[model samples]
Target: MNRCYLTARGMTVGYDGVPLIRDIALEIERGEIVALIGPNGSGKSTILKSLARQLRLLGGQVFVDGEELQRLSGGNLARKMAVMLTDRTKPELMTCRDVAAVGRYPYTGRLGLLTDADEAKVDAALAAVQALELRDRDFNAISDGQRQRVLLARAICQEPEIIVLDEPTSYLDIRHKIQLLSILRDMARQGITVILSLHEIDLARKLADRIICVKGDTIARCGAPEEIFDEAAIRELYDLDEGAFDPMFGSVELPRPMGAPRTFVLSACGTGAPVYRALQRSGEPFAAGILYENDVDCRLARRLAAEVVTERPFMPVSDAAFERALALMRGCERIIDAGVEIGETNARMAELIELARQLPGYNTLLN
Candidate 1:
């Protein structure tokens, strides 16, 4: 018995006469949600398009439930897989419900009138995406977010065992993004496999059971998010040298200002995070200190601060660390105290605060 619902073997994909990615082999199990992540122009969409049968596969074998993709009839393919592509195409005069109900065409007999069961599924799909209000409205008249939801509903009503979406959250607001992804999560739990490409690494980290890294004319890597999202992996995958990507938070930070320190900061916990960004935007080289290597503040400071003085987590601030921080603090012309909790382990923070008070220009950014 094979639990593998989708398999790609020796896949070589590209547009006419040229291959962008080659020799790819991967397997996706039933009900698992796999996310494709990579930097721009790395062929994420090209791969999705090939898998969805929208483009010619230069060379490869794609199997859906052990049946070769090319061997499947159009109707058979539709019954097994549903795709929501990146392209936005709308038909004139078709209502949202009419567009959505089209997914049932594979299941409909000749004459194509909507049966009660088909209509019920269509309605349910629309409601699932909270787009039922637009059901009667013209598809071309809806907003991009609404249109995206309708397209998703159309895919849902198809009720295939596998769903592939490419950058589905591009036009959606944060709320709608969460709602759509939650629905996809629910579907995967109910034994439907999902493959999606996301620009939102955070969302991918949260929702995907596995992540595929596409890069440089091949599948760079593929594994669980934990394996693929460490600082080194992300930096290499994205070829990022000027910015920092935090695997823990799935957040990205721009390059810090270069050269000598212009500002000093007193912070701990997560309090220093905003100050880092603020300093970056202001184009001021800065230094931050007395942060634990494992602190949330340290995670960000290491990227945006010219010098970040760090100690091991759970240890008291040592005299050497305090001296280093003080020297760096006095070198700066401005000081910002990002109010943090004063606890036994970080009691030396009080000394930094008094130092901030004595500094010529000092203030608390936030409490």
Candidate 2:
């Protein structure tokens, strides 16, 4: 089993006399990518800063390698851990290589001269981030993504046991985001502890070995990504609106349709189904409308005994089919629009929504 590299025991962090993260208790082990996530102003960054010794702990303690963090000297701490903050400062007349070399300062003697070994490590770090070609370029002149990578290279050059980053992918495009995360994942595999705060929950879900969800100035949950990404856990942690818990996508948004109801459901492709399932389970009368055979929702409608209005294989909808569907919908006491997908062929669903919106008793059941 891997040992814990960092431990927070009853940690309280905040500004002045006010505490933002109270009684926070978490342990980070070696060879793990731990992602800190939550809503804005929920103290995710605050906790990270506090762990990095950038913020004074209001109460409790943080331990690095079984030693009290506050008791560790700056130089000693630098050897044990490195931090990459999101904000960048303009360092005068420094090339990217020069800045990354600064990470070796803790190990250098009074002269602060780089040994041959130090130079080689700096080169390796730059290459690790794919920034070697840009080593001669001015750090201040590079794009935000490049600058961020350079900063990460600096931390990697430190060869610290634990690395902490604050929103490392903040300014990166999708490709750079994936690249940066892949680098971190590789670092964790090499027995380095990697902790970072991120805003993108989906990316966190995909990349992190462990997840810590901060909310209301405290940790709402901490576990494997699979454990924390559940609908109830995420909905409560993020304070999502009702009907936002989506099991399939692990997001709090529109509900997806399971299918048409047994009585009858008049929904089309991409129409969400929680409402349909709810009505079906309640034994309400329902049927499904103008369905294409291959549509997922249509398949569900068929299973539920929803009088399906379907078309032949790969054929355009006929006028007779439209009339039959209209007649079936007319007999229902109420019509529901489940927010169907819109396309050239499916635009008729929007017309149906519009028509329902104008009806005397039509209602919408949004997921």
Which candidate should be chosen as best, given lDDT against the real structure?
1
Regions of model 2 farther than 4 Å from truth: 243-367
Find the number of clashing residue pairs for candidate 2.
Answer: 12
Q: Give the TM-score of candidate 2.
A: 0.72
lDDT of 1 by residue, 252-328 (tens): 88888998998888888898998889999989999998899988888888889999889998898898998998888
lDDT of 2: 0.80
Clashing pairs in model 1, backbone N/Cα/C closer than 3 A: none
lDDT of 2 by residue, 111-206 (tens): 999999999999999999999999999998999999889998999989999998999999999899999999999999998999999988888998
Model 1 steric clash total:
0
Q: After superposition, how far is residue 61 of candidate 2 from its true place, in Å?
A: 1.5
Best by TM-score: 1
